[model samples]
Target chain A: MTRLVAIDWGTSSLRGALLDADGKVLEERSDARGILKVPQGGFPAVFEALFGDWMGLEGARCLISGMAGSKQGWVEAPYCACPAGRVEVGRSIIDIDVRPGSRIAIVPGLRDEHDGVPDVMRGEEVQIFGAMSIAGLDEGVFVLPGTHNKWATARKGRVAGFRTYMTGEFYALLSQHSILARTLDADAPLDEAAFLDGVTRSENGHGLLHNAFGTRTLALFERMATPELSSYLSGLLIGEELRTQSLQAAGEVVLIGASALTQRYALALRATGTATRTLGAEATWAGLHALSGFLDADRNPP
Target chain B: MTRLVAIDWGTSSLRGALLDADGKVLEERSDARGILKVPQGGFPAVFEALFGDWMGLEGARCLISGMAGSKQGWVEAPYCACPAGRVEVGRSIIDIDVRPGSRIAIVPGLRDEHDGVPDVMRGEEVQIFGAMSIAGLDEGVFVLPGTHNKWATARKGRVAGFRTYMTGEFYALLSQHSILARTLDADAPLDEAAFLDGVTRSENGHGLLHNAFGTRTLALFERMATPELSSYLSGLLIGEELRTQSLQAAGEVVLIGASALTQRYALALRATGTATRTLGAEATWAGLHALSGFLDADRNPP
Candidate 1:
């Protein structure tokens, strides 16, 4: 049985899963030492320290995903252009020789173009695949909410294309650094009512730049409290994001991310009368495991 | 002749003009000590140091505008509900008894409501009035480009209503703090072609949040250079701001702000086939001088 060490290494944190050939997780580990935290040329050392023992298992192979493939990561695993599925992505994996006999590789990110401008994604491609595998979906729309929220479309087992929105980052910037920060509680939990209000407000023909200012004015007029303002701001941004999307009435959006963020997206999608199914970190593990199949094919070409 | 000291004290800097009764700027002084930098309870001292001599002139009255009237400013001058012009604003001035036999007052900001959501502006109201005064027109569309860009309307010498866009602040935050900052030169001079590309990109119906991420991909693909990315981002934001405005074909926009910002706005406006006239710091001085007439009428009512 070929054991697998699957890793999701992002900008700020890292997680690893050790799985048996059946794609069943045997053990999981995580760390705050993401790509950014890794010292200059220290990726190999960090990777060895965190998952070295797991890799020692007989026939164990490792596949790293996310920012680990970014130029700033362990090694620059160049992006795989879109209309890519497991096979296309697997074929593009770049190997990094950590040791003379180690079998380790990084999954390439994906890029799609729109009107001559390109949009790129790092790790969410894995989650999309995982979500598809676990949900029995071959074609669907998926939303991954994070610092950079991505809306992706999959068709016939391949990621057709996707677009990125700075919704989450804008929320952070406005709620912590902009003037609205003065009147908002940055850490406050989601206030569904206030958030919905913001979402509804976003549909009012006024753009986000104008609607965002309302966050400050709402506080100044004592219309909304400080705790709810953050959620309201989040809603406004998420709502603006939704405003740009053309979701079909019968289509369901598969949301992949931490529950804290996906739940918000689920709520926002629900508000738009669209249904959603959410997948968490397990999707990342499942995705990396599924992609590991390509490694075996690469070793023994058809 | 009643000597006048007209001051525009905002968040980051302070400028004062010693004006004659005819609203002629005799001597002007400026400092980096905006309302935010003024030490707590130091407004009196700062005022005395910078323009106290001008205020000391016989019968000189000071009219302070901008954030100096906010809750955090020298004193909270409650906002005057809109449909406000020189008379309404002057009548609502909040006095701060600076010294015995001294006249020092802060002009109240303006608030307008749209569908229950409120939009407010402090310093820009003065600029709109000044723009109107200098342009020899009572009713027109006025845009003040700054930290919080205001799009205001005037009718019969009164500011009918306005909306605010956080374009400048968003540009600062995104260029200085957001992920796009990594690939951009935040202080690059405006690249007209790149900027126009952004403006044109925004018209594609993809919202700002989504279009903004293109900044990164454009750089990643080597399609756009680093310095041009900031200007492109600026164009995207200003373009989004313009998208929300409903400008009439025959109407002209009066832009008031520092030349650098207004020039960019003028460029964006021109892209939409709109004619614009740009004004500078002189607008603020002229605005306060024009409003001084209201102060006299307040003391001696009809």
Candidate 2:
């Protein structure tokens, strides 16, 4: 292939990277046009307007990840069942009929089940693959923190299973819309001390519904200020998410996300005596680049 | 007093009852003007507009409960500490200056602390007292469900301690604002089976954030209908709240609220093999009336 165009098109934003055959990012572009923003039958126009020149490169191929593969996206790329690795996910990469003689594919998401209930992740799968590749490890625990946080276990490069926590979304709701919003400054930056205090509070054996009310009471009692309360709220949620995992057994958790979110996770993880290593946007580019290699084998079987 | 005016002025609504010396509600009136709805310094105007006729009765004395006594309400009634019975709360009631030569008192809310973190409730304390008075039981677990659900334990005619659960508020947020809202009809009436299914699911030990995501998957995979999802979500939240309590040790729980909310609590409690007795608006009136009698002793100290 002359070039690989890797795209991470999620619910709220879209970003793409141009990488050489060696998987090094050469140029990057991003926009607010995520899958949800793209109108029906508008994906092609949007794609061409943003990345058409890059796609015009001789023998160039593009791979898109995230909600862009959902049923509501440009083309519905079905989810790959859990215990998926680079090979399983790669084989499932579906080619969409966007342009003639130019290969364009969407990475399928991954779905895991626990007691007949399903949990899913789309763009995060690529990041997981990228993290594994970057860390040069075959087995480990991976965490992707965002609007929805995912905790997954991988064995020999295959994600065995995972769970999703609505931690970030919940933080947004509680700090912005719930009764707690009355006293919290949701836009305040992270206060490490207040946050750790919240994390400590979560271990008090009273579940989240009960613990969350303390946010209001703490402020009402003047035990915590409004700005710090948001960080404290964040800690409570992140801590609750961490509570569900056997972190001590998992060893060093690999965290993948924006620096701000990963930093918070790292802090929360360390508070539990568990260690973490973080990766950023590079993981998405690397994962897409790695997945692109399987496209040729899928199109032309030996 | 020859007559008593009992009022439950909460966050979104204001209601009052005209009672005889025997504590019987002779007449009632309610308006959309809750404490939050009342304009600045408008409490007297609003109260006079709604209950002026009742207050005009000979020898009538008014007692108000709920958020109307909050710092933002008509007057700030300081909170009474836990292990408080009718006497403690009644003694703590603050008289608000509204009309000359007329008596008006605001019931103080109750505060309970666990390990330095405080949980508080205002109007619900009256309902708990009312339920105890109506059932002739001085000690039991009393649950008042509404925008905020309160679970309290009373012993020897005093509320020993209680916890607050944002269950109802969370149910509203998830069903109306979160991504799950997309597939749920928040206005649909309760579906007992679906609700019970959610309650059982809560016992699976995965916690709420993970269990809540099941709402999306169940709909995505065609396992449950959109309208029924709301009830299921409600069950999950209520179930989470219940999971924190020792229901078997509490004996028969007294549920106090509207028929709709109490009915749901009853259903959930029965699912756990815990017996429940329900009370309605009468509890509020009865609670205020019982406390009104204490005012005479407080004033005369005899």
Candidate 3:
């Protein structure tokens, strides 16, 4: 029976699972192991320190993905290029001397060039590939949402191109430090109607940068309620992304990166004219498993 | 000799100068003294407790501005309407628990409703009016840059209308917390061509909202050095503000709010086809010193 130890390290946290050949998690462990928070060149040490108890087994293969490969990590890996999807798992991902795993590898994210502008991503690419693997689909789009939202178009086991948006990051900054922050006393739920209203306004030619502060004026003037403003702002930012990013690709299948924080985006994204479905927490774990399955079937390091 | 106390109490800070009739400072002192920072209804007590030494001088008067008269301050004062230059200082301004000064009054800021948008300014309104007092010009435009950047048009001592932009706050949020924050290292003087370059791009029908993420992409692609991304992002935001806000008001005299933070907007203002000058600090003090001038000349209780 083949066993897989999979890791999904994200911007601020690390989670892992030891799974049986059938894809059921054996014993899972997680810790505050985000790459940004880790000390310089301390990825391996911190991971082992947090999850050493889970590594009691012998001769098990391990796979890792996420920002752990960027400059802030223990070792840097070059980002894969455009029309990029499922790069071969790097066998010698890093020469960190540590754990006794039989073999170790890291999945590469996707990248693309637009108008002389280049974009790159790491963890979400693997998840997109994994989502595709499970769906058994060809030529579709997948979106992984967060502070740095990632959108990828993949076909025949390759990502054609992808884009990233600063929705979550922008939300945090405006909510915490800016004047809009002062006015917001409570968290607001995502209002699809409000979101659509924002999209309509944006599509009607309200400049996103120009009308950003007007949301406050709207609140002050009592034209829009305070809570609805959040979703409106979301619509404004996401609406821009939909219109601008869609110029190149007419994506068919919209695989949403779903979470408590992400479900709000699906509301605004309806304006993009795509068929949407949410890939839940299981899909993240499933995406990692898909990579493991590919590796096992090939058994080759490319 | 007439003694006067000039006080400026803002949201988070308070500054006061005890001066002779000649405007010579006899003593100056400030504490953790914003209207918001101080305890509620503690204004009269705090003033007497803190400035007791400067009080009880014969024929002395005091002038106050800022949130001391908003709905939530020590007492409520009606807002002066638009095209607002300088409103006459109020006789019974604050609902003080105890009468302390020989003569005291508060200057109300301007508020206006334009195109269905309601806007208000408290202390800066006083400062701007003070600026016009020095210039002896009745009709002009004023640019008060801050967390909420405002472009105001005034005519014949009345503020006509104003629009607020979150340019400064947006820049702070993007540089300190967003993906742009991760991409940027520190502050750097942006290329004027690059800033205007971004403005030109925003002016296009494409919308500046979707294009903000380009800052992150520029760094990932190595097109921009990591450190310069902040400035570039700054350029993009301010550029959008210039293109959008300049269309809101018309006035040849761009009296910038006097501040280090506000000064950064000078270059951006100059780009908007307007002559810009920083408001002199003395102008505000002189305008408000009228408690000993205009009001006294009228022999009013204020």
Best-fitting candidate, scored by DockQ: 1
Tell me the TM-score of each prediction against the true structure. Answer: 0.97, 0.98, 0.76
lDDT of 2 by residue, B50-86 (tens): 8888889899899999998888988899899999998
User: Over the full model, what C-alpha lDDT does candidate 3 score relative to the true structure?
Assistant: 0.65
Model 1 segments more than 4 A misplaced: A297-302, B297-302
- Summarize candidate 3's per-residue lDDT along A1-302 as a digit string, tens digits: 56677887776887888877666778777778688788766777787776565555563566778887776665567777766545444322443346653455666655677676677787887677667767777677777777777777777777887776676667667667676765653368877787777666655443555456656666765788877888777776677666555533544545556466556556656555565667755565666666664454345432
- Sorting all predicted structures by DockQ, with the top scorer first, yields 1, 2, 3
Candidate 3 scores an iRMS of 2.9
- The 10-residue segment of model 3 chain B with minimum total lDDT is B88-97
lDDT per residue, candidate 1, A112-165, as tens digits? 999999989988999898989999999999999999999999998889999999
lDDT of each: 0.89, 0.89, 0.65
Per-residue lDDT, model 3, residue A186, is 31
User: Which ten contiguous residues of candidate 1 chain B have the minimum total lDDT?
Assistant: B293-302
Write the residue-wise lDDT of candidate 1 on B162-230 in tens digits. 999999999999999888888899989989999999999998887999999999889989999988999
TM-score of chain A of 1: 0.97
